[model samples]
Target: MIGVLVTFTQNEKFDRSTLAGIASELRGPFEGMAGLRFKSFMLDEDGVQARNFYVWDDEEKGRSFFTKELVDKVTGVYGVPPTIEYLDIVGFVDNSGT
Candidate 1:
């Protein structure tokens, strides 16, 4: 698996409620997204940043998803550019099922 960390930092603070709403609206589309194992939307209101974490089945799909277009699109949404980091998934734990 490949782990991806996408961080969006804004000069202005973001509303927690608004971020939650966005996450709620976006959940359905990502629930069964291909090549995506898991995804999380995280917010740091005090820090004025939102971090999105993703786990992909492979590096190719993960890297391919973060194209220039994606960055531009998200910059428009978040009002700032993002920093993307990809890392080898050394270990993972899922306790959803016994």
Candidate 2:
């Protein structure tokens, strides 16, 4: 498996409504994405940064979605260019259903 983390940093914390809007706009595009196992939207405790963590079946699957347009969109939304990192998923633990 592959893990991709795309992070955006903003000068200030995003308000609840802004965060909701971001999720609303993005949920459709991410849902059922090719080779994607799941996606998690994350926020830093300090509230200055946000990230999207995506788990994919492979590297090709992870790369297939994070395009230039997506980068531009993220920048437009957060007012900062995102930092993207890709890593191998050495292991995972899921207990959501427990």
Candidate 3:
């Protein structure tokens, strides 16, 4: 699978409520996309950083979504640019005993 890690610093005066709203809007669309397996988000207000872990079925699918259109849309919502790293998962350990 392919994974994407995104890290970003929020604008100092950014509104938390707006950030929450944007995140909420994104969940549905991301979950509905083909090849998107899962996503996890982490926010550190004290550190002024946010991270997103995204798992996709393959590299192509992940790359397609990182186009200018998507970046522009995301930047518009966050009011700050993000740095993203795309990676290929060679191994994993799932301990969920379901």
**Pairs clashing within candidate 1:** none
Maximum-lDDT candidate? 1
Models sorted by TM-score, best on top: 1, 2, 3
C-alpha TM-scores of all predictions? 0.89, 0.87, 0.80
**lDDT head-to-head 1 vs 2, winner:** 1
Query: What digit string (tens of lDDT, one per residue) describes model 1 on residues 1-98?
Result: 99999998877888788778878887998888899999999997486989899999988999999999989987887778999999899999988687
Encode model 3's per-residue lDDT on 29-79: one tens digit a residue: 777789987787667766477677898887898878788887777777676
Listed per model in order, the count of residue pairs whose N, CA or C atoms clash below 3 Å is: 0, 0, 0
RMSD of each: 1.4, 1.5, 2.3
TM-score, prediction 3: 0.80
The window of 10 residues in a row where model 3 has the poorest summed lDDT is 10-19
Candidate 3 lDDT: 0.77
Candidate 1, residue 78: lDDT: 70
lDDT ranking of the models: 1, 2, 3
lDDT of 1 at 43: 91
